[model samples]
Target: YIDLYNENHMYWVTADMYFKANQMGLLDPETYTQKNEDYSQKINEGQVFYSSMEWDFDAGNAELSKAGGKDKFVDIPWADTAEFPAWISRASEFGMAARTFVVSSKCDETKMKAIMRLFDFLFSEDGSRTIMNGPKGITWDYDENGVAVLTEDCKQKLKENPDYLLEQGANRYLGLVGQDYDALSATQANEGKYIDLRLNKEYVEENMTDADKDYCDFYGVDVPLEVSTKRENQSTIHEGYINLMPAENPTDIQRSITKISDYLQQAVPDMVFSETQEEYDQKYAQIQAELKNMGYDDVTAYFKEAWENAISNYKELTAK
Candidate 1:
C-alpha cells in the first residue's frame, strides 16, 4: 500500500529520481537504446561500473570466468546522504498463490489431514532437502561423519549435464515442491551443512566467485552468506501490513486507471528528458494538473478516505 493521496509522495516517486539523474547527466544518449543483454554485456566486460543484481551477478561472473577470472559484482545498499537519512526498504510483494502453487480443496477430514501432512513434510528440513537434491542415499547421502553430501553419481551428473536439476528429478517438479534451505541432519554423526548446496562454504568455494564473500564480509557475516545477510537486514523491512481499506475496486475505475497508466508512461520520459531544471520542475505541475483533469482527483479521494479509515481501524485493532 502507498499514500498516493499525498502529492509529495507523487513528486518523490516520479520527479525526484529522474530530476537528480538528469542533473548528474546519468542518462546518456545510448540509455534509451540499451537492451537487457547489452547492459549485462557492458557490466560483464567492465564497460559499466554499477548494475542491478538481476542483470549482473550471474551474467558478469560467467563472462569473467571465461576471461581467466576477474573481480565481480555485489549487491550493496543504496547509499545514505545528509538530506535522506533514512531508507524505507520493502521485500518483494506476494503474488497470487494460485499462480505460484497448486491448490486443492476438499471437505473430507481424512483427505484434508493427508494434504496438511504432505505440506508439513514438504516444508520440513529433510523434506525440502529431498525435493531440492533428490532421494536421500541415492542422490545425496550421509558421509562417514554424518554430513549429507551429494553422491559421486549425482556430482558427476551435475558436472556433465546442464539440465541435471530438472532432468534428474531434483526440482523437476519444482512447482509442486517447496525450495526451503534447511540445515541437514541433527544427529551427532552430522556436521553443520545445508541441504541447499549453494549455502555450503565448500560449494561456494567451488562454484561462486569471491564477490559473494565480499558481500557477506561487508555485513560482518560468519554463517552462510544468504542466511546471515537476510537475518541482519530483517529490521530494515518497513511495511508488511495489508491495506485493510482498498480504494474502489479496479473494475469500477479501469478506464481512468488505464488512461493514467498510459499517460504516466509518456509523462516520465518527457519530464526526465527536460532541457533544464526550470522545464523539469514545470513538468511536475503539468502532470499533476493533467492527472486531475483525467479524474485522478476523484480517484485520490477514494484513497485519502481509505487511508483514513485504514489508519483508524489499525489503531483500534492495536489498542490495549
Candidate 2:
C-alpha cells in the first residue's frame, strides 16, 4: 500500500541505490535483461564484487577456489549507514516454530505429556548433542572446559574422508526443537565448541584450504569466520513485515497493483536510462503524476490502511 514501505522508505532507498549507480554509468547496460543465474555466473567468474543474493560464504569460497580465482572472495558483514539501516533476512523454515508440531485431538493427556517430554529432551543439552552430533561418547565428548569436542578417532575419520560425519548419523533436522545444530547444541554443553563437529575451531583449521588461511591473515582473524563474528552486531532481523500484507483481496485493487508494478518495471529502467540527472528527476516527477492518473493513490491508500490494521492486529495477537 501507500505506506507499505513509507516508514523506512525502503522503496525509495532501493531506487536511489540503483538509479545512482545508473547515473554514474556503473550499472551494466544489460541489467534489466539479466537473470539471477547470470548474476551468480558472474560472481563465479570473478566478474562481480557485490551482490546480496548472488551467493553465501560457503558457495563463494568454494567457487572462488577455481584455478584462476586465487580465492580472493570472502564473506564480510554489510554495514549499515545512518540513511539506510540494513536487516538480515531470516530463513522462513527457522521461523516456522508453531508449524513444526501438532497432535491429534483424540490423543490422551498422557500422550501429550510424553510428546512434551520428547520436546524437552530434544532441547536439553545431552539430547541436543545427540541430535546434532550423535550419542556423545560415540562421536564426541566434553573436554576439561566442559565444551563439546569431537573424539580423536572421529576427527581423524573426518580428516581422511569429509563425509565421515554423515556416516556417524548427524543433522536429522526434522527433530530440532526450534534451533539449528551449532550454537544452541554446543552452548548448552557449557559454551564449548560448535555442536556440529565440522564447525569446531580445530576441525575448521585442520580442514581449511590455504586460501582460507590467507583470508584469516588478511582479515586479522585467527579463523576465517572471525570477521563475521566480530561484525555480528551489524546484522539484525525484524519480524514485523512478515505478515503485513493487505488483508483485503479485492480484484480491482489487485489489478491496479499489478498494473502499477508492471508499469514501474519499465518506467524505472527508463528513468535510469535517462542521460542526465535533470532528465531522471523530470521523469521521476512525471511518474508521480502518471501513477496518480493510473489509480496508484487509491491502491496505495487501501494497502496503507490495511497495513495499519495489520499492525494493530499483530500487536493484539502478540500480546495474547
Candidate 3:
C-alpha cells in the first residue's frame, strides 16, 4: 500500500486494492460474466472510480479526478496498500469478477506476451475509438483537413495548458494497450524543444571555451551522434567488467560483480519489505563468501581482459 497526504486531510491512502481483492478470492468467473451489468450499477450508485495500473505517479490522481485537488500535494505511501479495497469492493458490490496480474522484470516471457496481447486488443483503433472517443461530432469532431480535431470550446479548454489535455483523458499517449507513436513523437519533440531552450540559456555563452562551444554546436546536430561514441565503447566490453573494477585489489571482478548484484537484490527487498539492515548484512556476507569460493579470481581476469579490449578500441576510435 502507498499513502499520500491529501490537501484537506493530512493522510490519504492508495493501494493495489484490485489485486489484493483478486488474491483474496473475492471475484470469480460468474462475476466476470456479468461485468457490464455490474459496472452500470456501480456507476449509477456513484461507487466506482476509474483507476488504472498506469496510475503510478501522483499526477495520475489529477487525471482521475479531472484536476480536482489543490496544488502541491504530497504522496505518503511508499508501497502498495492493503486497507482500501476500492476496486475490489466496487466490483463485488456491483457483482463483477476481477482478474489481476502483476507485470515486472521478474515476470516470465509467457506472461509478458499474454499481457501484451490483452493490451493490444484494448488499445486497438476500433476498441479505444469506440469506448473512449465518444460519438462522432460530439466530444470530438473531424476538421475540413480530415484531422480529428476537438470542438472549438473543448479545444480552448484543453489548450488552456498542454498538461490539461494530458491530465484529462489524453488516452492517445497514456493508454496501456498499444504504443501511441504519434503521441510519443510529439512528446519527444516537445522535450527536445525544452532541452534546446535550456541549453541555449545555460551553456550558449559568447565567451565560452572552444570545447564548450563545440559541445553546444554538436548538440544542435543530432543527439544520436553524441551517444554513438558511448554506445561503441559499451559494445566492446563484457557488461560485468564495469562493476568488477570498482572493488579493492586482489578481488575477482566477476565475483565482486555477482556479490554486489546479489547483495543489492536481496538487500533492497529485505530493507524495503521484510527485514532490518542487520538481517540483510548477515545474508550479504554469506553471498559474498559463496561468490569468492566460486572462483572470483578467474572471473576477475576475464573481466580485466574485456575491459582492456574495450579501452584499446575506444582509444583507437578516438584517435581519428
Best by lDDT: 2
* Model 1 root-mean-square deviation: 6.8
Where does candidate 3 clash, by residue pair?
1-79, 1-80, 1-81, 2-77, 3-76, 3-77, 4-76, 31-97, 253-300
List ranges where model 1 is wrong by over 4 Å: 5-15, 22-25, 28-48, 53-56, 79-131, 138-175, 178-197, 200-208, 214-219, 222-249, 291-320
Every model's Cα RMSD, please? 6.8, 5.9, 20.0
lDDT of 1 by residue, 200-260 (tens): 6665555544655666667666533443334422332212123345634566466777888
All candidates in order of TM-score, best leading: 2, 1, 3
| Poorest lDDT segment (10 consecutive residues) of candidate 1 | 90-99
Model 3's number of clashes is 9
In model 3, how large is the Cα lDDT of residue 236?
A: 24
Candidate 3 lDDT tens digits, 271-313: 2231344654465455446545655556656656766865566
* Candidate 3 Cα misplacement greater than 4 A, ranges: 1-65, 72-158, 161-277, 295-301
In angstroms, the error of model 3 at 76 is: 14
Model 2 residue 116 CA deviation in Å: 3.4
Candidate 1's error at 308, in angstroms?
Answer: 11
lDDT of 2 by residue, 27-136 (tens): 87877888877866766665666544524434555555545455656555445354443342222322323325668999999999999898777656566567677668
